[model samples]
Target: MIEYFKSDARLLSPLYEFEPGCWVNLVRPTSEEITHVLATTGVEEDFLRAALDPEESSRVELEEDQTLLIVDIPTLEESNVEQDESKIFGTLPMGIIVLPNTVITVCLQDTTVLRGIAQNKVRDIHTAMRTRFVLQILLRVAGLFLRNLRMIERDFTKIERRLYDSLKNEELIQLLGLSKSLVYFSASLKGNEVTMEKMLRGRILKLYEDDRDLLEDALIEIRQAIEMAGIYSSILAGTMDAYASVVSNNLNIIMKVLTVITIIMTIPNIIFGFYGMNITGNDLPFAYWWWVPVVISIGGCIGAWIYMKRKDLL
Candidate 1:
């Protein structure tokens, strides 16, 4: 899908014609739409292809007069129906192409960052101020990371509580999934930080005082996200370790109880085995004396029990 927008009184209003100082947002563009954009906008096909490739890395490139910037953005997808967890999240690449009097954003899927801009939730959005607009998008991406990270943290905490009473793989599976997400976010945030730092130091965008400040703010947010990912990853790791220890300790307790019971049981078996043996079948000591073994077995069991109790093995 493709939509065009122009700044209208601090809001993004849909545009019906190809206008200068407009924003073109594309989501999963078709081949024909791709060809048309290529022909009309004169943007090289390489940039569009990279944007369409979901596996593309985050980087900045220059082709002719346009600057192609790709950044990875986080997204959530529902887990399989059989999975107890509701959703899992990861990053996908988003492309931003800076052209004269226009800026184009292309991504494989719709994101909150774009929707917020469409809804006029952002304070100021002037298409003519392309550099600042890009900064704002970066800022929104950073905030989105923080928002999603908090959600992951909360969900993991809930799962942690569920895992307290019982050991189940479903909850741990979800934790593993979330941990994988944090790894992606960490890498992407680092990539975006480098890109932003380069922009700050390089002449890619002519930065005004306000633009510089906005860029710095976005940079700070990105750094915060990086830190958040690291902290969450560590927390998840610790949780896994704690659960492992709990399980190991429980197993030890179970084995010890079973061992004590077996030893107590063996005492009776020893008495029965010894009493059944006889040198002469008919001349056995007290021929009709089956009760003798029973009394002996009972006495032996009691003795074993007393010994174990004293030793605290029970």
Candidate 2:
């Protein structure tokens, strides 16, 4: 879908007409829609297709007439939580093509930052300038990464508590899922940082000094996100290991208690078996005496207590 917005105001007209500060937001546009955008704005077809490809590497390239900036944006599948490993959650391809008169964005899925920008929540004073718009987009992406990092941290905190309360295999699986998400985010953020740095120093975009400062701020945010992801992953891995060990120890204790009980019970069975055997002196000794049972009961109790105390099962 193609939507046009001018500084926080949505335009209803199909015709692309706007003053200096407008942004054209594209979300999951079809081929014909992409052709229409390019036809209206004079953007290159290859540039648009490059942004549409999911496997496109994050980079910034300049053609004869326009600059193509491809960056990785962290995205999660719908209805997916941090612990859903089977869910599709990773970086998506997002493209920004800066033409002389307009700036066009292409992405496979919708982005919250783009929506916010179109809503005027993130105001851009220079909407007419494509380079400025591109920089603003980069800033928005960096902000999104930071937001995702915070969310991951909060999730880790909750899961960590659960791990301590009751360490189970299911909880370990959830932790693994969270760790995978963090790893994905970290790699994507690092790639984005490199692309932004290239844009800053390459001067292909010819960004103004003030815009350069904005890009620098975005880079810093990306770096912070990468660092936060690393820390969270490390902490989560350590917690998982510790919890697994704890679970194993608990199982060992349970098994030891059951084993000790079985051993104590077997002592009485052995004594009864010997007396039950048909022997010549068995009847004369104490076979019919009630004291024999009493003696066996006392011995069993004493043996069980001693074994339990020695094994720390009591």
Query: What is the lDDT of every predicted structure here?
Result: 0.86, 0.76
Q: Relative to the unseen true structure, what is the C-alpha lDDT of residue 84 in candidate 1, on a scale of 0 to 100?
A: 65
- Model 1 compared with the native: what TM-score? 0.93
Candidate 2 residue lDDT tens string, 150-193: 77777677767777776756666666767878878887887888
Candidate 1 lDDT over 1-314, as tens digits, reads: 88899998888899865578899888999998888777777777888879788778889998768998898899997775365653578999999999987899999998999988988988889987899999899889989999999988888888899887888778778878888888989999999899888889757777899999989998999999999999999999999999889889889989999998898789778866666676565755555788877887788889888988998887
Error of 2 at 17 (Å): 5.6
Q: Worst lDDT window (10 residues) for model 2?
A: 6-15
TM-score of each: 0.93, 0.88
Error of 1 at 165 (Å): 1.3
The RMSD (Cα, Å) of candidate 2 is 3.2
Q: Find the candidate with the highest lDDT and give its number.
A: 1
